[model samples]
Target: MGYGLPIYHSHCRIDENNQMFEEGREIIYVNASIQEDTALGRLMHDMFCTDSRDMHYEFLRKRVSYYKENEGGKQEMCEIWEEIKNKGKLEGLREGETIGKQAGLAEGKILGRQQGVIEERINSIKKLMRKNGYTLEEALDFLDIPKEERSTYIGIFTS
Candidate 1:
């Protein structure tokens, strides 16, 4: 006799003669399908019949529109919307930070390689000057180092 008890049948035949039981207790079945135009029927139809994402989204949109028009449950809707927005923002920031770290590491590796190459060139130039008895000007000219960049190379070699 309790409300919301499910109806079971022995066969597929559905009529006034069909009886259902739950835990050996007979349950009463009220036909709500007769009032399919009611609000509850429509809500059930949208929930059960809608299969596609767009259809479900549209159903939710209409439900929200109804709630807004009736001025019902505004506070709950606002809180849910805020939670969804904050979660999206947090996920975006996390993804952006991950991408930034990857790019920064790649750039640092490139710069480190470039520095290593420059250091190797400086060492070669210094060796040419000391072991080959070449003067600073000769070493600069032999290595094709410009006059403006000579001071930096000289400082690295001397120090």
Candidate 2:
């Protein structure tokens, strides 16, 4: 029979309990292997090969075995790992510093605007007090300022 679609195959074995009561068919086993010339095979070979000193293959078999078996090699791996970690940490810190500076500048602008409003209100309260001959407490009360925050306004305007 000629099949129109691609046929995929795999190696499989049936267990002793493999039984289909309705059909009662005996299971057959088959195995398939990929050719080394295939793309996946080539990629695996390139990644696992230890014949070259390429930095991309940092976890080569020989280097891994050497680091496991020798203190000097282990120390070298530790140092390399530490250096990589430090580089990442430094980058994160720089990013955090930039974000912090931006937030600080935004907060400074908001506080400056609030101070301007407070200064305007203090000038208004002072005019009311001088023009109407009202006491500091009376002026603050007439302006509807909270008693707790009155001292802050007083300190700023008086100074």
Candidate 3:
């Protein structure tokens, strides 16, 4: 692992050549610290970024910004959690019983957790709206929800 520069991606292989055989195994490692000018270096830097604003790549930064700064992005991330839940379900099922049987069990657990977070936020918005006598938009704005993502919760916000 190397740190510094804007970003980089780590690449690993058994040897310098493109041989896939298990022979003359020579580990190849390209230190990111020295490869700061390369694309991989930038990718590595992007991976270590804690905040979207700190990211070096516009593509990665924009995507992260969508999830962090936008409320719809939050919901989108929850859906991603559900997808991971399904994949995780598949993984655990591959270890035990038939894939179909255990699929729902594991997937739902992750989905439920994500949904719980979404539900909690929704409830908070509702609570603020009722207690503070705020409109839906005002309540969402008060909670720092991004304007672009506001339309996503319109229906749910009403009922």
Best by TM-score: 3
Candidate 3, poorest ten consecutive residues by summed lDDT: 2-11
Selected candidate, larger lDDT, 1 vs 3: 3
lDDT tens digits, residue span 54-90, model 3: 8788999999899878998997786567556544644
lDDT of 2 at 73: 83
Candidate no. 2 TM-score: 0.33
Q: Compared with the true structure, what per-residue lDDT tens digits does model 2 show for residues 54-119?
A: 323445555656775579888667746754654564456456656755787565555555555665
Task: For candidate 1, write residues 41-146 as lDDT tens digits.
Answer: 5544555543333223475757655555445567456545754654564456456655755787565555555555655665677578658978777888998877
- Candidate 2 regions off by >4 Å? 1-104, 157-159
TM-score of each: 0.31, 0.33, 0.39
lDDT for residue 154 in candidate 1, whole number 0-100: 68
Ten contiguous residues minimizing lDDT sum, candidate 2: 1-10
Highest lDDT model number: 3
Report each candidate's C-alpha RMSD, comma-separated, in the order given.
25.4, 25.5, 12.7
lDDT of 3 at 17: 80
